[model samples]
Target: MSPTSDLLAAALAQSGFHPRLPQQRRLYEAAKAAIHQQRLGAGGKLPSSRDLARDLGMARNTVIAAFEQLAAEGYVVSSRGSGTYVADLQAHSASMRGVGATPQGRSTAPAATPSARLSRRGQELTSYAAGPQFEIQPFAPGDPDFSSFPFKLWQRLQNRVWREARNDLLDYGQSGGHLPLRQAITEYLRISRSVKVEVEQVMITAGTQQSLDLCAQLLADVGDTAWIEDPCYWGARRVFQARELKLRPITVDSDGIAIAAADLATKPRLIYVTPSHQYPTGAVMSLARRRELLDVAVRKDAWILEDDYDSEFRYTGRPLAALQGLDHDDRVLYMGTFSKVLYPGIKVGYLVVPPALIPAFRSALYDLQRPGQLTVQATLADFITLGHFTAHVRKIRQTYGARRELLRHMLAQKLPRSVTISREESGLHLVIELPDQVDDMALAQQAAMQGISVKALSTYYLKPPIRRGLLVGYAYCTPEQITDYGRLLGTIIAAEAAA
Candidate 1:
């Protein structure tokens, strides 16, 4: 078939014709849209009725009837012995435009550029640096090993969900998510992370990004103070900025956020922290610091947004108990995502809110995002109850630990001792600190050219006084790739330093 015929065939097959509409009418509408959109250009010859009918799995008569209608409507022209050609509508289109009328003769308003149409808030939100394009390369940060996932088992569970599907499974789920899934998450968090929560306080989100968006919207108002950890997760930062929250970057030290006495004068409405394993820089918040922050939150009447992302992959000592567990005032909004532990495509995360705010958060989530994925949630619940979730976590922790060691070893052997590698005991990536004079951004670009994916640590900071380093991820890369790429990256870093 010709390209035009193939395009039309795809259009016809996927146009989602209404059940009540006859096939001929559907075909006529689809064809008219193609012509009006100029996809079928002027004088473009259409396929023969017989060819079109075979391609679309319709009767030849149906195709002929549709074609006749289109020609009658001046969308096409049929010749004596030649194929039908798309009619030239340039003159008609120009005439309509001149009179400020659309092809359907509706009076149209003046067209405005996208920037002009957007609100001031929209422009500010768009101006922030959206993270990388998520390319899968040597050391792209926070990416899990997709090949290691048990797809067959996951498929079997999903198949079972559909096989025994109920009306509730197909319909819109509760704003708080599938009850069983929420219960499962509650149990898991209580045992694994020491997150004290009931199923009623749990709300399912698409991911941490959605959870952040919801919290920013519901917990705080526009222009209200939001304290975010310096050099924080860009995703959370973006969410707060989008909600027009006034962000105060709190400096992070050896123990998570170093809250100074002066810094607490202007009380914040919300406090965002990754106390488990800080992003880019993997500083586990000390127990003392956790208690201090909790006390501060209570004193200031602030809500602490504890993002326990990647807490399951701790490789040394033990995974620290979540900061939420220490909250006596129930002011902490604990968030966790399956993206880091499972795969990113799962698109499932949970936020454990305070009991009092449950109704507000649930209603707001439903009204704003309309969260639904009951089938996936059901299968995930089954996977957890069957002990597959913990098993998977154990299996990947060993694999990632090995990869992390190999990459560290390779880089240590190749790079100079002057380059200081962070000794954080957990998380997917490691930060290699550089001298103040070395340009980490330029080094990152040069490493990318060599096919080594690493993020510049300087870029993570919200304000200046930034530390210079590169975040090299080991969770996604295999031993062989890590060894090879680590050597190349080491050489690149050494050269950059010498220059």
Candidate 2:
């Protein structure tokens, strides 16, 4: 048999081509697979129909039809007088191929690996760790108490929207999201978080993650400096990095991002801050720091991304207002998510852009991400307007507050005096700062083995970890589990310290 026929036969068997298929289709698919797999080289001559048919025990007509199909699909070329030849796809395939095909018309290179197929940026982006795991094990940070969400009411609202579903609701929704949801969000933000936003400026996103991605793409150019809080949210760091931005990690103090004369000289194009409630550390940005940051943004012509995630559950004094509310220069881009308050699977969040930038942001969000889930957006609008959202927040705040206190009490009572627990006045998780000798990452791993799901605080940092701590969550754990797992975690820490 000819080399082409041998490859075609092998590919047919290896590809699991069904024998029951029509001979023409089977031969066509087998030939195409061999060509795609580069077993058939560019410009290689195909065997005569009669010879291939006889070799494969197929009718000549079947082989002729298969060749014609391949030619029609540009997989093969015919010169009228000369026999058909495999199309020269080398130019188009160069990006996907290593070196080149061998003399036998087969690729000597290994399978196309990620390093070969993905772009430089894509390869670098994939190296970072993914977002939080959702196992909801004891002390898992970033997960709200799912058991307490009013699923029955949510189902009823979703069903109502579906039952009355109009063409607009079912179609590609407005890039700014469902109008009612935007209006609802505007009202809630103005009243609760003290954000200054109009309904027109609101653009719904998949969540804050998508919001970060949109900001990275729209606001800053490649290599532009972005000021990120050191020991920041890993997801935000990844998003900024994905856009190829230069990250300037600003150290965080009791008051949000500590600005230095050097940092002001750096003059970043974008500044990301979680001012209301800092992640892991839970330090609320003081009013003075908020104004100073705003001033810096104005002076540098920069944009501030204020991620107000999980600020609704404040147990202490009045929650500090969002940084966006303080921005007189319209340099702040406020981001909020229902994921932490409701559930992660809900996948609804909003970005409040400056009024003038709304059109560009809306168009970019639609063009790039095409935010949808209109039905869910509609349901969330109802949840907020009908007072369910307020009641739910109030109830969970009380519940999470009790849980937070119980866990704090347990840790204080059981752990060594050297182990300091900060008063995490707001948010779902708290950091347990350990002595410098303790390896927080190793402690987290040990806790994971015992079905605890805390995060090592050091991993969140952009610089070498200066602090050793474990981030333990309370919102997802029931009161009983807090007492039980809290003791277990304390015991583990004590043992590690003793060692």
Candidate 3:
């Protein structure tokens, strides 16, 4: 197959293209993924729009819509007699990449890899390539047990939604999202996370990554700096860096996201933090630090993107109220996801911005993503309203809590002297800090080869302290599986230590 067709096939398989998805969306996703990952290169000529649409079995208008969107986003350009081509992003936008390409029929030598043909920004993104891996093996961070999800109930809800599905429900929804789902989210946040927001302030997103991208795009400009906790969620870092924003990796302490004396001197346009339960390390940002961040945001006139990631699964004394709750001023942008609480396939996440910012947020989001599928949103709202969402969280919390304890016990018994267990108060994952001499990445690879999906603490660090360790997730595995994996991991560590 041609490279363009190959990319569509990849997207179809990777995204599990459902007939329910709009044809325009499928094309857009495939093209974006292809371009961003450099599977499609710069200056390459596109097949005639009509021919391509026919090949994909999509209506011609659907393909036109996709191309128009891509062009608007600076991904492609059309000429009067030369035909359509990928935008030479570098030639037009300095900070943008993946747009400009070598024209077809040109005699210039080809770049070695897709990455080489990309813009500087695009090449940087490939450096942190997190290839897809969803193995349910021991210690895989963020891999939840989907088998335990109430798929039957979900199917029934989906069935009910489709039976009553209205044509308008499938079209571009209110840029802010389906109203009922937003209301449900508002109510849930009020009681559960102490987050206060009206339905108008909450915007539905595809995932946390999309939310981050929106925050980066709308709040900050290219080359503007943003502060993220060092050893942070790699996904967030990727989004910010891809936008050509200068990322300042602030160090994290036991208190969480400690702003250093040096860091204070640098002006930031945006600040991204996981204040509820910090990723990888699992450290909860102290109330005092939360206040400090809020004050800093207010004083600096910077936007704070609080990724309340995995806060729902907190296995602690009533989960801490979200950092957004403490912000008196409108500087904080609160992000929450249904992926962790419910399941990733739900593809529903929401953002709460300040009231004054809602109109702009809605407009920008609609232009950027044109996101909808509200019939699914309605089903989610019904599920939340009927209490299944809460009940499932309660049940999963208890189950994951037990698994956490089991993993903790096993690690202490198996590798007590060799590793340090830090931050066990919240979230689905824990850190077992290893010796400085051990190479975490190599060890993790060995574990994976032995059928364990593990993450190295070193991989998360963009700045110093840069400790070596393993991140073991307990939410998905059974107690027995934890023990078995713990022993296997310990064995690997012991050998690494010896080496």
Candidate 4:
């Protein structure tokens, strides 16, 4: 038989339309008809493993196995050095057609009912949306210039870890993460952030998002109120909302989240704050406000979630001590992530819970979550203990600080008279307040068209529209890119203002 015929026969047998195996014979017969009817034809390569896998909702290996089986049956022929090909089975086509025949002509099958498609609850969440084409610029908040990351050093460490890893390293690691990593984190946080916690108090998580989710579950019940900053992190709001916890927006000024009469009125179960540098509005919580917040948490019997994100990149004098350091009442639940200092893809973060909560927190994490790769964690711990992590952060801090200055200078020179930049002291991002008349959403969309991605501050608010502004990040952008991004953003703002 020719290769085409041989392939056709093999495909038929592989599909299982044989005289035996009655359970799947109907499907096999149907598939055979589709092939004969030119629905699947000669000279056409079989569907890719992925496509077949999807169609059958089976693993790719299964489809590949079936194809191999067909080749073995001599219905399909495998070329000595080429891919499998259909056998020209013209001789048996007529006979095979009769096997599945009905009096009407060919047996017809019932159509499959469509299954419901799953979707995420709200509108598709993205940092930027499609819009006008602006100049290619870097405006994404909190994205460090990935190009500056020590790829060579990281690869060397990764290679070393992989070479040294035992067979056990391939298995599921401790849910609390690799022990050495936890110890390294404990030591580092104690020395750097002044956090008083042992390795037992720390729980490794898949970065800040997972840490926040775990915290929300552990600390608050459904319907419990969680106070977030007015111009807070949108991601945290999403996390809170997903857990069905009520999010109350507390107003923020130069001193961070204002925890006064209004915050007390909400009777929040947990208060989430980015004390080191507030999100969107880059205000650091003053010493007085931090003290007051700790006191309120104690008085109200509420837990304070200190999201000490981006504290490592403080450009000014020494970074402020974490609120966790000052909390004598054990009210602070500290969260930190390597995403800001390193790459987000690392997915390593630590949550420092009060001593009382450690046991329960570890148990919850153990029961509900699986640990990340053991080798990665162990290697990272070695990196930190060896001082590479500190050195990398120090180098990047200077690079980002210079980039921030360039951005600030460009903004001052190019931004419209009506727009004002706020809180440039310490963080990867700065906020630019726009006029009330300009719609931030429209401006963001317009800027996106110019190939620039800028965020609108109004989107972060839960209640009480606070400030209309753009949260521009310069960390990932180079000095040149920062200048260009600022200019593009200024142009967009100016055009919008003129309009």
**Candidate 2: Cα lDDT at 128:** 70
lDDT of 3 at 300: 83
Query: How much lDDT does candidate 4 score?
Result: 0.75
The candidate scoring highest on TM-score is 2
Structural similarity to truth (TM-score) of each candidate: 0.79, 0.80, 0.77, 0.73
Error of 3 at 25 (Å): 32
lDDT of 3 at 89: 42
Better of 2 and 3 by lDDT: 2
Clashes of 1: 0
In model 3, the Cα lDDT at residue 215 comes to 92
| Candidate 3 local lDDT, residue 194 | 93
Positional deviation of 355 in candidate 1, in angstroms? 0.8
Candidate 1 wrongly placed segments (more than 4 Å): 1-108, 129-134
Tens digits of per-residue lDDT for model 4 on 22-101? 32343334444554565555445554545655555556676566656554443344443344444334423332444322
Which one wins by lDDT: 1 or 4?
1
TM-score of structure candidate 3:
0.77
How would you encode candidate 2's per-residue C-alpha lDDT over 1-65 as one tens digit per residue?
A: 98888887776676557778998999998888787788888778899998999888899999999
Q: Model 4, poorest ten-residue lDDT window?
A: 109-118
Q: Scored by Cα lDDT, where does model 1 land?
A: 0.86
**Candidate 2 error regions (>4 Å):** 1-100, 105-115, 131-134
